[model samples]
Target chain A: MKKDMRSGFFALIGKAAGIVAVGAGLGLGVNALRADGLSLGATRPTVGDDKSTAGSCSAGPTTNVPEASIDEARALYGKPGVTFVDARSRADFERGHVKGAVLLPYEAAAAAAGQASLPVPTDHRLIVYCEYVNCQLSSLLAQLLSQSGCERVRVLKGGYPAWASAGLPTGTGP
Target chain B: MGERRAANGDGAVSESAATSGVSSSCAVTRFLEGPIVQIAARLALAAIFFYAAIPKIGDPAAFARDIANYRLVPEEMVSPAAVMLPWIELVTALCLALGVLTRGAALVCAVLLAAFTAATTAAVLRGLNIECGCFGQSGSGNAVGWGTVVRDAAFLVPAVLVVLFDRGRYGLAKAIKRP
Candidate 1:
């Protein structure tokens, strides 16, 4: 029995090695034919593109939350302790932002531990926003907050521009 | 011992005679289990993985960045993972498609899908609104959420089916062997 098992193990490994060799050959052979060849560790994704024109944010087909309109955001902004988390850079935030909105950018969230630095009140509803409809940061931030156990996470519709255009209040610094 | 051997030989002869008169239903069953069905399954899985591998193989750096977006793998391992993953996909795809080591290839594909399902499930549970990157960079319209997880889960069925049904027939490996 022991000998049989040993032989079986060796046979399986041998077959697996053959399969790997074949796979490597096919992959590399095709890769070598490419115009660019194989480019490893070449570039990183760019941080932000402000030319967003989409109407809504989706985390994916699943875990999508209802979008909060500018009017809804304004209504919620006045209410005590409702968190409006800005998913923009600190530079962007310092230039101009919705009054009382906290800066918890998506790039920051990628590196930081879950909700560790943000002041997320347990009872508050978190409304996240970035640069208009095309900006994915807001959706990503909302998703992160939702993942971090925020029950009422929502993304602001049309993002910061809509709020500003609606003649709502704005702030800057720190 | 000779008497027993003669009796066994007679039993085999009778069994072969019985099987020679196979029913239409039995023939249909055999056809279903034969090369056609196996080949179709192999081609479908191969096409999918091949489509996935092409975009990633050329640009491992971009793929590495996509992997980084998931934050699943460690930073140091990301580069190596990115370089090898597409090649693995391509290899298994070729093996399965060409029927070269078909079962082994199917097993590899099954394992890859299982890993993808786990990763996507983790992302879903984590409330991540991210692209799946299963097929390189996700299109702008497609979000990597629960739908992606379900899709990956669905792809697993064929891989599992191939692994179970492969009998070393209708493949390049078998074709090359002279009868």
Candidate 2:
């Protein structure tokens, strides 16, 4: 009886291993065939640098977008040619945002890419931000804006929360 | 005549009473180990995994971003995990729902649930205000919190039960094995 139980346990483990192997194989195979598949070795774009891993497998033209520190953004604040673009949801924007920041939520901007005019002036330097550093919406929006022919685009390093925490100027409204 | 003699024999009544008690308990155990309970557990887990897999499969890039937000995986490995995890969930779901390799799929589901629980718990402790990314990138409302940790932990019960007690009854595995 003990032998039978031991064998049963081994058989179950073997089956589980087989399932994982098959699943991984199918996943890699399918991803390879898809157009939008990501390259496995690619690194996320780092702050303050234009060096970014080719994001997708297709290896399209890469964009050179940098991230700006809070101080740098503070320096640029209220400048004639600089604009702060909030990439968070409309609700988040309404709750609070960087003073003078224009609300352009990431999802809406992505959907309207190539068709709609972005809220910022074409010639203005743009600084994009979402909730925090880990949030990707700001980076994604910055990329979209750069791809849409915005000359100078930068993601805010720590995002709106970081700016607000640093005692920077802020506002709350639609 | 012989049976009556046995019933009336010394200790026979006590033996019968003991036998009745054992059988009643056995019946409850048998019902729990039966096909009905096993099938329900298997199907419920299957539905959840299937629902979670679909959106991630459709948008792996966004899914990768979500995974990166967790900050658990190294940046380079994030893409591969994001690409493969949805497929694994999908395959396991299909197997569980179809009653094919039911035990194996249940084991995978249990492991996945454990990992998710751990990730969410870590996020909560660290106070990272981010989406759970349990379903997909658009899981905007599924924030990582103690509630998310509890939900993933709760899912493990059915998954582990299916792994241990599933006997392949009413499953494709049995049919496929038949010559």
Per-residue lDDT of candidate 1, residues A50-75 (tens digit): 22211122222224556898888888
Candidate 2 chain A: worst-modelled 10 consecutive residues by lDDT: A51-60
Residue B119, candidate 1: C-alpha displacement in angstroms: 0.5
RMSD, each candidate, Å?
12.7, 7.8
For candidate 2 chain B, which ten residues in a row score worst on lDDT?
A: B1-10
Could you give candidate 2's per-residue lDDT for residues A38-111 as a string of tens digits? 77885454433333222121213447679999899999999899999999888888889999899988878765
Error in Å for residue A169 of model 2: 10
> Model 2 segments beyond 4 Å from truth?
A46-81, A86-126, A131-133, A137-174, B1-25, B137-139
Count of steric clashes across candidates, in order = 2, 0
**Compared to the true structure, candidate 2 yields what TM-score?**
0.72
Question: Chain B alone: TM-score in each candidate?
Answer: 0.79, 0.84
